[model samples]
Every structure is written in C-alpha cells, then in structure tokens.
Target: MALSSSSEIVRRPHPLEAAIGDTRVLLDVEQGLYFGLNGIATSIWQRLEQPVRVSDLCCSLKAEYEGEAARIEAEVLAFLALLDARKLIEIRA
Candidate 1:
C-alpha cells in the first residue's frame, strides 16, 4: 500500500528485537524472518517506539540531517514502505 505524508507509522508486535551497536535486529517468530536495520533505519525504528506520522518523521529528520526536504521525505517514505511490506510496521491513513 502506498503511504502518504499523513500516514501514521506504528511498529507491529514482534517476537524479539535487539540493538547491537548502531544496528537493530528484529525477529518475526511466526514467519521466522530476521531483519536488521542500520543507519537512518535504526533511527526510524527508534522513532517508531511510539506511533508517529510520516510527515512528522520527515520534518524531524530533515532538521537533524543536511538534506533537502523532498529528498528526506522520499527516502523516509521508501524505508517505511519496506517495513510495511515486511509486516514489521503498520501504516494508518
């Protein structure tokens, strides 16, 4: 499903998750899939500790990173799309 700036992101309840240095490891017990997150993804995951809107995430990241707003929004949306496709996150319109 396509995500818009207003879409809210929430982490799905998974079996396990761990933070190893700058990376985050997540496990889907029933699906038996292991996922790893690094760099900005790790930050994204941390932000998802609470449900947040895609636009808000982009705004915060844009302020923290040296990048164009459009670029940051596109990348954040793409990353959230991946997490959503993996069933690791839920996107609420």
Candidate 2:
C-alpha cells in the first residue's frame, strides 16, 4: 500500500519560507516544483509530516473547512488526487 506514514513524507519550511508564508508553506517538495497552497490544503499539508491516512486527512478537512464533513472530505480527496496526478504527492507504502 502507498499510504504508509513514512514515505508520505513532508517537511516544514525552514527559515525564510517559514517566516513569511502561512498558507503558501511547502506541502511537498519534489522535481523542482513548489505547490503553493491555501486553506484546508495548508492545514492538510502541514499535518502530512508523516504518511497520513485518508480518514486522518478528512478529519483535518472537517476541522478546517466549513459545511458537511463528508462533502469536504470528497473535495479534499479530489484535490489530493489531482496533486497526486501532478506528481506532487505519492501514495506511501
């Protein structure tokens, strides 16, 4: 499975990026790409320091975004899938 916490790796922005950026924080860094993010994405990205389960991500979505949790979960998952397709994130194993 590609949902292991370790390979789902995330890193906090060190110094400069951390100092100024809140929503723009580095969620995942690879292949010379930097995905600037906002809102639940910012929340989820920060929490993804370890390989996180989809349910865990949904929890964060619930906490961050308003409206139905299930609705937010679907939206968040879809966005995550888009990111995955972009090679921005990978399923951890």
Candidate 3:
C-alpha cells in the first residue's frame, strides 16, 4: 500500500532495538531477522515511537537536516515504505 503525505504511522512494539555508535540495530525475534539503520534512519525510527503524519515527519526532517523539501519527502516515503513492507510499522488511514 502506498502511503500518502497525510498517512499516519507508528512503529510496532515487537522489534528489540540497540544503539551501536551512530547506528541503530533492530532484531525481530519472531522473524529471526535483523536490520541496521544509519544515522538519519535512526532519527526517523526514533520519531516513530508515536503516530505521526508523513508530511509532518518530512517537515521535521527537513528542519533537522539540510535538504530540499521534495527530496526529504521522497526519501522519507521510500524509507517508510520499506518499514511497512517489513511489518515494522503500522499505517493508519
């Protein structure tokens, strides 16, 4: 499912996470899979602790990072799509 700017998203509670240097590692016990996040991805994951609109997330990321609005939104949507595909996050209508 493609997520729009207004889509609300939140992280699932199952993944166990750990911080290693500038990266964040996530272990999904049931799936027996592990994922590693870079610094920017880690920031996005941290923000997903609660439900938030995709546009709002992009806005915050744009403010925190030096990037074009369109570029940031595009990257965020792509990243969120990956998380959604992995069942690591819930997308609400």
- Candidate 1, residues 1-93, lDDT tens digits: the string is 569999998898864999888778999998999999999888888899899999999999888889999999989988988988889998887
Output the worst ten-in-a-row residue range by lDDT, candidate 2. 10-19
Better of 1 and 3 by lDDT: 3
Task: Estimate candidate 3's alpha-carbon lDDT, on a 0 to 1 scale.
Answer: 0.92
Tens-place lDDT digits, model 3, residues 55-85? 9999999889999999999999999999999
| Model 2 spans > 4 angstroms off | 1-22, 25-30
Q: Candidates 2 and 3: which is better by TM-score?
A: 3
Please name the candidate that would achieve the greatest lDDT relative to the true structure. Answer: 3
**lDDT for model 1, on a 0 to 1 scale?**
0.88
| TM-score for candidate 2, residues paired by index | 0.61
Output the better candidate (1/3) by TM-score.
3
lDDT of 2 by residue, 20-78 (tens): 35556443433455566776666766676676777777766677567787687667667
> What TM-score would each prediction reach against the true structure?
0.92, 0.61, 0.95
What is the overall TM-score of model 3 with all chains considered together?
0.95
lDDT leaderboard ranking: 3, 1, 2
Please give the CA lDDT of all the candidate structures. 0.88, 0.58, 0.92
